[model samples]
Target: MPLHILDRLNHPLWPAARAIYERSFPPHGRKPEALLRRMLERGQAYVFVLANEDSQARLHPAAAMALAGPGGSGLIVDYLAVDPALRGQGLGSRLLDELERWALERTTASALVIETEAGAGKENEGRRVFWERAGFVAPDGHVHRYIWVPEPYAAMYRPLPGREGGLLPPPSGRQLFRWIEGFHARAYRGFREEE
Candidate 1:
């Protein structure tokens, strides 16, 4: 049977969501389940589950994407993940489409924005291709540095009509640095500092 997508936060099958994420990104270096719970608690995140229509049991999450409220002028894609088993099955694209439709339903948002690593490594290259295929364009003049790594990363934005410049303002170096610091603090909260 085909899967149906639902928006139940307390769905019985929610626990498996983390396992699916772990399988896809084993070396992700962070626990996604904890973060997902936090996001959901904040009410800024949504979980879309793909399940069998007959029994409503989750087969697997075809795709999962979270959107934070409008930062400067647009919405930010806080996180996006798809089950590895469902990759390349058009589920990712469908999830993105639903996200856009969601944004359009909001009266205040004008565009959607997301950040991703830049350049040509296996992971980075694949991410770039996916965003490009989803209609995201890398802005010509913006670069944000990674907190853990010294290298800088590019920013990408997808302008929605009337919200072209409504998204978060481009970050300055000082601002970016602060962001990096915050990211590291949260991402490694319980880990001991290197001696």
Candidate 2:
């Protein structure tokens, strides 16, 4: 499997990757396609599609992920989804692993962070478990609420390995929240938050 960084709408994998992204999240939970395009064009994000080669060596998208930051703040897992037909095959984990490597080798991010729904529900619980299995842990206190997102979310992070393979310390919850907020500010520049 290979991870393709799709930074343009004309990329060969864009259609499949976009379809998978649209189907994975509800409209309110996802950025509009136009905004996503702007993010790519501005180099504000890293959008990746995990692909596998077919018999003829043609690559087909299996999963998609996008992230921002790691530009001194931290790397946030903006969105990650395995194709509906390919769910339960551990492709999500594989993609995430590749993402971590990319971050480690390519940036100065101190940690890899994610936001999962905070309420009580099986879906939320399952998401938490999946991230936890990947070594992400929630901060001791705080359910971060964003002005634009209706659902309350909890922040989780796995500190990246530092120089000489030493582990970086986890960031404080306040710092993590700030990094998340900064990402939203940049990604949603023209949109206003509800009061």
Candidate 3:
């Protein structure tokens, strides 16, 4: 039997979801169980888990990303990670397709936006290429600072329709922080104090 992907929040597959995330992401000094719990609490975000039927085992998610609505604009993907073992398997592309489909159904915003590091070396360069292949483009005259990682990254955008007429101005630090704070609040609802 083949593996299938499902929304973790809707399914409440915390144990399986945490396992997949742990396998894909570095511990980074944060407890994996706690992190997964926080991500689940962020009701605004969606987590897709891939599972295999044959073994009745949730295949560690080959790829994962988080989405949030920022200021009523389209969905913003906060994080995207693919399992190291499955990098070239097309899982990332499939995961993105799911995100777009979900966004199209739920919002009137004309696009989905994300950020990645600039000059991020080979690893991030590959990620940038992946985004490009998926139809995303860099906004004209706009550069984003990706502060979560060790190094900063630039922001990228994928216009759905009608959004091509204009570009959202880059957010100021304070504004960006407020937006992220909302996202964090939702994402870490139950784990806020530890986060």
- Assess candidate 3 and give its TM-score to the true structure: 0.66
Q: Candidate 3, which ten residues in sequence have the lowest lDDT sum? A: 1-10
lDDT of 3 at 158: 71
What TM-score, computed on C-alpha atoms, does each candidate reach?
0.67, 0.87, 0.66
The candidate that achieves the highest lDDT relative to the unseen native structure: 2
Candidate 2, TM-score vs. the true structure?
A: 0.87
Cα lDDT over the full model 2: 0.75
User: lDDT for each of the candidates?
Assistant: 0.55, 0.75, 0.55
Better of 1 and 3 by TM-score: 1
| lDDT (tens digit, per residue) of candidate 1 on 1-195 | 232322444666565655555565545543455554554565544554443344323464334433343444445655566666657877666666666667777546565566677655898889888988988776564667655656567656566755555545744434433443454344445544331
Candidate 3 residue-wise lDDT, 10-83, digit = tens: 45444555555666556662334445445546445556544334442445423343334543354666655555
Better of 1 and 2 by lDDT: 2
Candidate 1: 10-residue stretch with minimal lDDT:
1-10
- Over the stretch 37-149, how does candidate 2's per-residue lDDT look in tens digits? 77778787868888767662344454555545443356788899877777898888888788788888887776788878988899999999999998888876788777767
Ranking by lDDT: 2, 1, 3
Cα-based lDDT at residue 193, candidate 2: 42
Model 3 lDDT, full chain set = 0.55
